[model samples]
Target: MSASLICELCPKSCRIPEGEAGDCRVRVNVGGKLRATTYGRPSAVHVDPIEKKPLFHFLPGTGTFSIATAGCNLHCKFCQNWELSQRDGTEMEVRYQADPPKVVAGALQTGCRSIAYTYSDPVVFYEYTFDTARLAREKGLKNVLVTAGYITPGPLRRLCKVVDASNTDLKYFDDGAYRRYSDATLKPVLDALVIQKEEGVWLEVTNLVVPTLNDDMEMIRKMCRWMVKHLGPDTPLHFSRFFPMYKLQNLPPTPVETLLRAREEGLAAGLRYVYVGNLHGGAEENTRCPSCGKDAVRRVGFQVLEMGVRDGRCRSCGGKIAGRWGA
Candidate 1:
C-alpha cells in the first residue's frame, strides 16, 4: 500500500491515507501523491460584475469571469455557497470541464477584464488557481480571488505572484467564533491577509456580520483597528449582511442596522473605504472621497452610475484612492 500523504496547503494539514482525501475533500492522496481532484473541473462559472465580488475599489465597473470548484478549507456554518464550497466533486451533479487555458480563453472571448476564482475558497483548488492565474496573466488578463484567507504561508506567497487582487472573508476577529462556527482558527487568516498586503496584492476584506455570532461591536472595533495598523487605513473593508443558510439556518439574518453600526465602527477606526453589502437600497454601497466627502464612484447595485476619479485619484479633491483603476 502507498504511504499516507500530508496536505500542507492550509492550517489543517490533513494527513490522508492512500486513496483518501483531506479535510477539504477535494484534494486526495492518489498513489501517495497529494493531488487536487477538482483541478480543471469547475463546478460553477459565470460572468458577474466586479462589485458582486464586493470589490468596490479594484477595477470598478468591470465584469469578472468567475469560476469555482467544489470544496473549501473552512466549513463555515452559514456558508452562502455551501452547495459548491462544502461538497466534493463526486457528490456534485454538475461540473464543467475547462482547463486553465480554456478558462482564460473563455474570459477573453467574453471580454472580461479579470477572472475571479471565487464562489468557493480558491485555496482548496490551489494548483488549479495557480495554473489558471499564470495563463490568465500571460493572456493580458488579471486574476482576482474571493476567498476565506485560510491558506498557509508558503502556498499563499507562491499564489500571490499571479493574483492581482483579492477579497478575503475575515469571518470573525475572535478565535472562539472561528473555532466554533467555521471549524478554523483566526490567526492564520489574519496572517494570510498581512502576507497578501506585503506581497503587493490589492487586498480587500469582507466580514459577514452573522448576528449573535460575530457581531459584537467591541470585536468589530478591534478588527478595524487591526486592519488600520497592519494593512493601513486605505484598505477597503466590506461588512456583508449574512442571511441564515446552510447549517446555521436557525439564526436570523443580520439586521441592516447591525451592518450600519459595523460600517460606522470601521470608519470611526480610521479605515478609509468601508462598505455595507448583501442588503440593497442604501448609499453605503457608493464610494465617497475621504478627503472632500464628495461621491467619487456612484453605484446602484453593481451598476456604476459615474466614475468621479481621474487616474485613481478623486476628481473632486484630487485625493488618492487606493485601488487598481487602470488596465
Candidate 2:
C-alpha cells in the first residue's frame, strides 16, 4: 500500500510519497493515508464586518465569523499575512481545537450571517472549510471565502456547492510575474473565477498593487479589459494599495497616485464597479450606478455611510444595480 494519496487539490498536484507533505506543507501523507493536518485546528478567528471581506455585493453591512488554519498554496513574497500563510501547522504558535458544530455555534453566538474561511489560503484547509461550510449551510448561515484561487477544477467545484460568495485575489495578470513572484501560475486562477461565477457564487476580485511589481498602468488596463470580457462589467474589482512588508520591505508603499490611475484605467476598460482600498477616504470607495452615475452604495472607511440602493435599483434614476440587496 502506498502512503501517497495522489494530491490534486491544487494546480501543484504535489505527489506526497509516504510521510511527505504537499507543497502547502499541511496536507501530508501519513501511513498510507492523505490527511489534512490542520483539520479542526485553527490559528485565527474573528468576527468581522462583511465589508471587511471587501465583498460589497454579498450581504452588505452584515457581520461574518472568520476563521483560518495555517499554510498557503502560494508563496507570494509580498504576502500580507505571511506569518500565518507561510508557516506549517506545527509552527502556528496558536491553536484552537474546533469542529464543524463548534464553528456553527461560534457564528451564531457572534450574530454573524456568514462564516468566512480566510487569513490563509482556504484551499490548504479544504476538509475543515468543507465540513464547516456544510454545517453552516444546514444551519441556514452563509459561507464566504477569501482565497488566492490557485486551485484545480475538481475541488473548486466541490467548494462552490457550499460557498455563497468569494473574494479571490487576482494578484497579477502576467504568468511570468506570477511564476517569478508568487510561485504560481495565472490560468488556473482565471479558471477558478470563471467556474465560481458559472456556479452562481457571487464573486469579487482584489488586486494588491505592489509599488513596482504589478502596478503598471498598461498591465492594469489589460487586466481590467480581460475582467470585463470574461467576468462582465458589473463584477466589482478592488485595486488595493500595498505597503512594504515581508521580503519586499525595501520598496516604499504603493503611491496613492498609482492606485487612482489604475482605477481610472479599469473604468476606461469599461468596468462598471471599480474600487480603491487600503486608503482611508476616496470617491472610488463608493459604488455608483453605471447607468445613472449616482452613488448607489456609499462607504466611509469600510463603514456603510449611506446606501441609496432601493431594492437593488438606483434611487435617483431607478437603474438596476448589480448586487445582493436584502432587507
Candidate 3:
C-alpha cells in the first residue's frame, strides 16, 4: 500500500499515509492501497428476528443471520454499541473469519431468509459488506442493511444493488445536533435515505429519543414531516427509547411519555406506520391499519404474536399494507 492512498468511502475522506488507518480505524493503508482490516474478520454473529433490527416494514417476523466487524464512522455520544463500534483495527478479537461464500453458506445452514449487516456501522466496512451481500444474493438470501446511512453515494449505490431492505438511523433533524454530538452531518444521511428509497429498497427510519439532546418535540415533528414529504406517508418511522450509555450516560432513560408523544407526532405528520421500540408492553408497538385503524401486526417483544393480513390486505378494512408479506 502506498502512503497516498485516498479513502473516499465515507464523508471523512481520509488520505492515508503509509501504514496508517482511516478515521474509522478499520481501513488501513497496507503496502500502499487501502485495505479493509476487518475483511472476513467478524467480531459478532447472531440470529435475530428482523424486528430486532426495529424494521417493522421489512420482512417483519422473519429471522436473519446478523453479523458485524468492529468500526464506526460516527463518534456518537450516546452509542449503545460503542465498545465494538469504536475499537481500533487490532482491538477486535476475531472469533471467526468467514468470507462471502462462507457467510452465504452459514445463512443457508441456519435457514435464515435474510442476511443482516448490523451490530456496528456497516459504512466503515463497505468492502466486506459489499462482498457478502453479492454472495448472499447469488444464494437467494435476501440482504438487509441495519445502518446509520453515513456513506457516500458511489459506495452506497453499490451496496444497495444487492440490499433488499434497510433500517437507517435518522439520528436527528438538525445539522447542529449531528455536528455537536456525532461528528457528522445530517444531509448525507437524508441523501442516502432518498437514494435507497429511489433504488427500490424497503426503507425504515429510526430516531432514538434521547433525554435532552434529540427529544425536542419540534425537531421530532420536523423529522416526520420531512419523511412524509420525501419518502412518502406510507414509510414506517420508529421512535426508539434511548437508554443512558457511553459518553452520554449521565442522563436518565428516555421517558415512555416522550416515546408516545413522538409516535403521535409522526402519525400526525401523516406517516402511516409509526412504532415505539426498546420498550416492552407498549400498545404502540403493534401495527395498525391506516384505513380503519385495525391491529394488522400484533407483536409481543420481538415475536409476531398475531398477524391480521389477508393477501397482504388489512383484515378489517382491506387496505393494502406496505411491505413484503408471505413472499
In terms of TM-score, the best-performing candidate is 1
* Candidate 3 residue-wise lDDT, 24-47, digit = tens: 898989888788888888888899
* Model 1, runs deviating above 4 Å: none
Q: Which tens-of-lDDT digit does each residue in 1-327 have in candidate 1?
A: 689888889999898999999999999998988889999999999999999998898889899999999998889999999999889998899989999999999999999999999998899999999999999999999999999999999999999999999999999999999999999999999999999999999999999999899899999999999999999999999999888899999999898999999999999999999999887768998898988898899888888899998899999889988789875
Model 2: what TM-score? 0.98
lDDT of each residue in 110-177, candidate 2, tens digit only: 89999999999899999999999999999999999999999999999999999999999999999999
| Model 3 lowest lDDT segment of ten | 88-97
Using TM-score as the yardstick, the better of models 1 and 3 is: 1
Give the clashing pairs for model 2. 3-32
lDDT of each: 0.93, 0.92, 0.89
RMSD after Cα superposition, model 3: 1.2
User: Can you tell me which runs of candidate 2 are displaced by over 4 Å?
Assistant: 1-3
Question: Alpha carbon lDDT of residue 212, candidate 3?
Answer: 87
